[model samples]
Target: MEYILLIILGFFAGTIGSLVGLGGGIIIVPALLFLSAGSSLFTGINPQVAVGTSLIVIIFTGLSSTLTYMKKKMTDYKSGLIFFIGSGPGSIIGAYVNKEFNLASFSLWFGIFMIFVSIVLFLKDKIKPLNQSSSGIARTYTDEKGQVHTYSFQPVIGILIAFAVGFFGGLFGIGGGSLMVPAMIIFFVFPPHVAVATSMLIIFLSSITSSVTHIIFGNINWLYALALIPGAWYGGKAGALLNMRLESKTVVNLLRLVLILVGARLIYQGLL
Candidate 1:
């Protein structure tokens, strides 16, 4: 029964994470903490363990979704690799710092992160991209529906933001998609499909880097991880398929709603 619960949890987390580029930690970490607090077989998870376990699970989630996105030609592999320049080391550093969090504090801080994402989405159109006049790094993409998008970002700023996003992702075990995806769409003017697809690529790589540090800290719960991976794997695939079927604006609107709800839950949990 405990394992069944974990499988179900993993499936939902993966689906939600992959569907909206959240990377699933937003669901998994909190659920683990919630489950641990209950009188059940899943118990005794500290924040560090939860974060570490979530990071590893995100790897499979990212991989499964990414592979599906690849077949559809949706992922921006080159851009993902470029952004990793900063996110990789930042993730390592964040993982090392994860030891500092307690359960309540982690929820409080992560809730703030969620709010930040919501705010960004709300103001995305109002805020202009950095150095809008400067075509620092530009690219063009045409989506499955033959919609063309040409976007650009200042290279240095892009890398730095990625590092910050990676740090937060590593700190919270969320794969940084919450911040990265919005930044891509708003600042870089990336197409929604491209942003979601590329963000998963970065998530997969950053998770690997962060997970190694967690492994060294002995923060992973191997049993829970083993139970979660298979479900997360398949859910990721399911989510990617669903995402492709939806319109870009619809995806963003849906993501916005989910972020707000998730953020509220974390904030409420933290206060209690």
Candidate 2:
């Protein structure tokens, strides 16, 4: 039953993570923390350990989601690669920094961050895009529906943003997807689908580095992480497909809802 629950949790995490490029870490991390607090099976689980497990799980989530997005031709490989380059070192730094903070304090801060982010996502549609008068690096891509999207942003700004996102992703084990999607949309003017697809690729790369760091630090519980893989894999594929069918606003709203639930729960736990 415990294994089954883990798989189910992974499935939900993978499905939602792929759809929004939030990488399911938001779901996985909190669920693991909750399990630790509530279940004998997860006794001794700490936020850092939960974060570590979340990063490992994200590896599987990113793999399944990226493949599905590739088939749909939704991924912006060139831009995604650039994001990965900046995110790599940042992830390692974040993993190292995670060890410096008190787990309870860190968890509380993370919860607050998520709440703030949730508000941003909720109001994302109301935010205006960057001024187009200043032209950026011109780019174009086509989605699964044969719609071509042309947009631009300063590459340096995007790289810096990716670096920060990766740092927090590593530190919090949220895969940076939750933050990346919003940044790409609001700052870079990336189309929602494009952001989602590209975000998965970035998360995939960054999470690998973070996970490796966690392994060296002995933060991961392999038994728990392994239990989530099967569900995460299959769920990722399903979520990507669902993403192609959903409206962009719908996707944003879904992310907002998830963030609020998870963030609030974490805050409550941290206070206890």
RMSD of 2: 1.7
Model 1 TM-score?
Answer: 0.97
Alpha-carbon RMSD to native, per candidate: 1.2, 1.7
lDDT of the structure predicted as candidate 1: 0.90
TM-scores, one per candidate: 0.97, 0.94
Write the residue-wise lDDT of candidate 2 on 1-50 in tens digits: 88899999999999999988899999888788778777887676787888
lDDT of each: 0.90, 0.86
Q: Could you give candidate 1's per-residue lDDT for residues 184-246 as a string of tens digits?
A: 998888888889989999999999999999999999999999899999999999989999999
